[model samples]
Target chain A: MERTPITVSALNAYLKAKFDADRQLGDILLKAEVSNFKRNSSGHLYFSLKDENSQVSAVMFAGPAASLKFRPKDGDRVLVEGSVAIYVPYGQYQVYVRKMTDVGTGDLWLEYERLKQKLEAEGLFRPERKRPLPGFPKAVGVVTSPTGAAVRDVINIIGRRWPLARIIVYPTSVQGTEAKDSIVRAIAKANADARVDVLIVGRGGGSIEDLWPFNEEAVAYAIRDSKLPVVSAVGHETDFTIADFVADLRAPTPSGAAELVVPDRRALLDQLDVLARKLDYVLAKTLSAARDRLSSVASSYVFRTPERLLEKASVRLAHLDERLDLVRPDRLLADRKANLGHAETRLSSRFMAILAAAGYAYGRCAGRLELVNPLSIMTRGYAVIRKDGRIVRSVDELVQDDHLDVRLSDGSADCRVLAVRKGE
Target chain B: MAQEQELKFEEALKRLETLVRELEQGDLPLETAVAKYNEGLALAKRCHDLLKQAEEVVVKIADGETLQDFPKQRE
Candidate 1:
């Protein structure tokens, strides 16, 4: 029989209604791998759930997605619990995923691995970047549920190990939807205060789901960015969270963190005792060494026999005195007297030669004088007359009556002049 | 003595260690060594006293509402 042709929209609407009405399709569980996962701006997650041979489209609305402990991503093997429905506009059948979980190891574990790989690639888990816990922390800040056993364990352990440190608890929720935000805020508050030298962020042992907040990225970043060194001590020794990898130090338990952050008082006291003893021994050794040096100097030859220096000085002075005697004034004077006597003898000889020369000259002068003498002329029969004690050699000097004296060789005679005569 | 309380355990320990090393080196004059020995003794006593007399841990709740002592459940 011939029937009326229906449009694509009408057929899709009918199939959607039929699927909604079926009880088997209303609540179904499918084990599949997530593929092409995309979270839209409206917070709705859209993906395709696929088996080895088949595939089905899936979508988780914003409300259920908000409650998810882990974010679903492509290639994740998950068990989705939801209803099967058809989109009327697209004419496609898809699963409306209400709850999704990891099939083999739980989706939270897979998510944990995924985040660990991502943060590790970003160098958040580098060993070189990890800081050492303070050896003597004055204050320790704990981020955990204040009412939980973890805080008490930390407080007591720190108290017993090192009672000097002060504990400041940043009370936070350790589980549920609000756990991540609460943990992040507590870390921030501790950092902002800047009073604590080291921080311990952790919770007591619980299921992976209960401990999921510690695995959150916000908490990891908070631990990474904290100025104070952070010690991560979450769950049992076997449970490792992302915060553990990003922290400055990882403790197997809350008590372990406490032990790592502070030094043991008893151990320190014992060490001080050892050092004190060492100081005593060293001081004694140093003093003895100084005394040894001083004694060695004091027993030297110079100090032992100071008179030897003075004796050597006296010998040098005697040698100098002998040298001075060679230049004595008495010896010098005797030499000068001998030289003067030799000079006196030479002077006497020179005086005798000069006297001989003077005698010969006087003899020659006397012979010449005799030749010019009037007495010698008298011997030749010549006479000189003097009138009025003058010699008259010219007849013009005779006067008619003048008294004259005739000078002879031996004597002078007095005569009277009677007449004047002219002679040719 | 109260000022010694303000001294950090690590700082005190470091100074004590240095003093021990200086004494061990053995180059100081006798008088200087004696003085250093006395000072070292004082530091050691201070360190020992501080460690022995440490106060118990003080716990405070950080809820951002009111800062109060966290009551201990047991000693």
Candidate 2:
């Protein structure tokens, strides 16, 4: 039997050549659980991959990491598709993963989804609990890592959108076991401070494990209970976490969260301008319409017939005047005065004439009475005498004459005569 | 009385809207329509003035954890 020594360089070169030649070895699929994963400054990933029986080292460069849709972490069961190669410096075989996918979505992912669903069922993701972002937030509170690209993005976006907003940075652990507690405390502090109007809770994009604290139940509960409205901006646009569900609002990125919290001054002004113009148009149209209506009413028949309305009253007044004319006081008084004057004149003249006639008649009557005076009759008296108290004046009386006496004017004679004489 | 108070921009805008509707309905007396038209004109002016006087504001939040006044963009 004989033994021969080999050169280390020759053996290593041969092994490297073999690795380079086998295309199937360079492009194969390996399924294992992730362990001791760390990202370097140059953006290269280093980690261990293990199965139930064997373990191997793996590396994924920044270029491939960037292309990956899902983040990788410790204990993540992954199906990696890459070529097997030897690291010349270490002289050891390792996998350079090009593409990777989770094995059955991994246990961590299942737990994450379960918690997310449970919280959602409890109404934690309800839109009604969401608060409207302020049109112009006076102050803003931030809960994230003190030093990260997320902080820079938010600051830049907010500064660009609204310069007047006062920013309050609350430093917290963003990617470790203690991160959930720290974030919760910061949110509480910001809420307790009356000065904060809104909050932004987020961090830069990273591996799923790196971003796990934001997905924790405690962190989500804290966000749900915050008095100040919160905008979740944890990870990149495609990444969703529990904080997103519980927050008042969800932004695709940290920069987006800043934009949501503060209003765009220029856009607001532009909107106001448009509204002002609309208001003016509405007013002008209204006024013109009113004016037109007013003109129409002014030309209506009621105003035009005013004189006709007065004509009816004038006719009625003339009728009243005619009725009043017949009973005038002056005319009645003049007629009564004329009647009184005529009666007084007629009465005086008639009485005077009657009185004169009566006086004449009375004088005549007195003259007649004077002619029948007794002295006149006595001057014409004749005397005769009768004898022995008897007087006979006719022969017819002589038959019974017993004694007779006669007397002339200067002699005396007595006679007795008894005779009856009848005269018609 | 609330409608008549056009001292504020929002109130003025509301009055203008009401006036427009009234004019569109075509039922107001001529004198009343004229009065409303004059009031609408005044309200429009008030609203325009309010819009013109408004200024904009910007703010910046850092790391989604810190807040700061946004630096004005250099035109």
Candidate 3:
């Protein structure tokens, strides 16, 4: 192998071509810690990926760097996925990083997935088991670090959105070795207090290590066993945890949970106020109508001459008392409701016909109500008895000592048969 | 008919017109005048809530974009 040696530029060029042609060298995945991270004004990322024994420089252009879920700072453990390339100008080799993610979170994600499947298998995350949140929550309990942005956002939103609801902060450490137990305890306390209408469990966005408590199995069970409806608001929009699965509702963020928990009162105030006015209008109409009837009745000579009115009433009562022997009051009432329903159908159909012609009116409601008013039927002191579904017209309809419903204009009475006279 | 019963805009406005005329004339019987005045006051209060009667529901977020409402779904 005796020969002239090749030039440095020629050798590097050849090495670069070899690196590009080789498939294994083209595609490589290195799990290493980031070091010497730097960024120039051009938006290209410069860093070294190092493990215990070896190190390699890497560059992620602005486009790919912007897509990274986690920032690659110094000492950040990352799994850099890209191709290996020879820098022919520098006569050195480096990785061209396409994607980079924090290694710690990757493992946490795997753990999260495993626990989610396990809990889901036990039906803890069943949709049917999730309780419906109260439409009007008087108090909302939040289990989060009281000092974090999450609690502040929830409180602020709830206050502005629905001031009627009281925000009760069940403060807890959201991360670290003790965070899992702290969250579990805080949830328990909220349930035990039993004052809050609903519970919100979450924390602000953070790294996986900071969000690990929410992914804990204990937190999932705590949420599952909650008495009040649990709303899970974990990290950013993309993060998912075991607690989210077990919660009745999973909000993308803490502020979103607040919006969902209680409706904005600005919208509801109008509805309630409208109903209140209608209530007043309906009541006033009833009063004025009653006054009109009273004045008209007062002017009648029959009321002035009391004996005349009494005599007429007694005679009518005698006739009705005679009819009372044949029928029960309950059957009569049911028949009246049935007739009213039929009338309502007929009147409503006519109402629809008039409405189709764009003709609408009021004042007929009182007359329609009068048709169903049992008081009008009993006005003359008439008392009738009904048996089964028919008016009792004969003593044959009765039995000895039978209890009968004696109906009157005022009300019905349960009358026991003292005696029965046949053809009397 | 139930829907018609809830359409109180026409009734409220007509009543208000009659009430203003009656009040303006100042000849209504004392009790009638008092009752009419109260009814007028209630109708005025209802007007405040309406801003104007709107058939469709519109969600007004404090500082958000205009969002339309979906039709109610019944089970």
Candidate 4:
């Protein structure tokens, strides 16, 4: 018996119905590597799921894809749970993925993420714990692949930005299985070096696997334990590592790390120069202010005419006397005559007292001078004989019978030393 | 010796700044102003000397070498 041919749409619909009827097959889990992924503007994800044996078309609709926490990319190993449905239009069966989780990472990354969350909750990522970069570091230690461009970039940038910085490079493996240990050791070494002001640890960009060392707990702990400030510069701008979170400073690139470690040379010089100029300006302003004050004081009336205040009072008194003389002529004249007689008597008495006081002062001063005067002593029958304008105290001071001038209170006389007397 | 020793650069600078502000206020008498001005001059000289002797060093971890110069050393 010949069987009737069914349309492709009808056949596909029948298969879809059967698949949906089976509860187990309706929600099944499939594990495969993603390939040929495509994303459209509508936000739906389309990709082929493949294994060594076969490949299956997979589609994550816009709604479910929007809910996905992680982006699905090509070459990702994932476990997708979905129901297999037949498309009538395409006459094909495809899996409508409900959920997808990374598998190649083998739960390690997931566990790492969970631990990170726990640590973050404990305030390990607190901003307060982050140290400040040194404004002027004497020495910088870099922990990265010595042969890699990361070291070179750091060196070049640091040199250009601050030539005074002394950079020490510690060679370490930045990637692979042993990278974590190498990084830890290098960081430890840098911390131990007393001369190191700061430590910079990082590597160039790569896939997640290539940058796994920075995510290691050991590396993070080393950074946290370091006494010296640590800077993390790992992978690309988008890539972040545990070390970055634990470090004192996080930079997007190796060169950025160098910039964080040292300040800009030109900027520092400019600042110093600015400060110098400010000091000079302040000094000049201060001196000018002082000079202005001095000039103001010098121009004051008191300094210009010291007797001006007294002169004004004297002129006012003279005007008052003239007005009194005109107001009452005889009375003013009589008062003036009486005042003159009283003033004359007072003046004569004051004059006599002053003269007496002056004579006494003069006598005291003259008596004091006379006691020290050689001529006064000669008045007591002791004559002072001088030779060569000097006193002839002894015969040894002059030649025998030398002509001498004798000084007395009355008069000075020229005489000759007739005899000399020795100590008897 | 420590007592006779000069003040640190930052300490002297702070004192000098305070003195300048005081002088600018014009509160001190002429004698006091002159005295403070002399003190400020001494402090300024101290700061200048400290800056003149200022030295900074940058050490590299790779070769463990120190580069010395003014603040903000480059490669």
Report the lDDT tens digits of candidate 4 across residue range A1-424: 9999988778888888888798987999999999999998898899999999899999998988876644567888999999887777887788999998878665667867986887688776889999887666766888898778787788778777765556777779998898899888888878877767788899998767788888888887888889998889998886777888888889999988988887775665454455445545555666777789899998999789978867988899899888876678798788889999999999999999999999999999998998888666767777877888887677678766788888788988888767777775
Q: Assign candidate 3 its CAPRI class.
A: incorrect
Backbone clashes per model, in order?
A: 1, 38, 9, 27
Q: Where does candidate 4 stray beyond 4 Å?
A: A1-74, A79-100, A117-123, A126-128, A304-424, B1-75
TM-score ranking from best to worst?
1, 4, 2, 3
lDDT of 1 at A101: 84
Preferred candidate (DockQ higher): 2 or 4:
2
Cα-based lDDT at residue A179, candidate 4: 88
Candidate 3 has an lDDT of: 0.77
Candidate 4, residue A120: CA error in Å? 4.5
Global lDDT for candidate 1?
Answer: 0.86
DockQ for every model, please: 0.46, 0.16, 0.02, 0.12
Q: Which candidate number maximizes TM-score?
A: 1
lDDT, candidate 1, A10-114, per-residue tens: 899889899999999999999999999999999999999998999999999999998875556677788889999998889888999999986655756778889
On lDDT, the candidate that comes out on top is: 1
Each candidate: what lDDT? 0.86, 0.75, 0.77, 0.77
Error of 4 at A32 (Å): 5.6
Native contacts retained by candidate 1: 0.84
A239-305 per-residue lDDT for model 2 (tens digits): 8999988999999989899888876656754655555455456556666777787889877875777
Candidate 2, residue B4: lDDT: 23
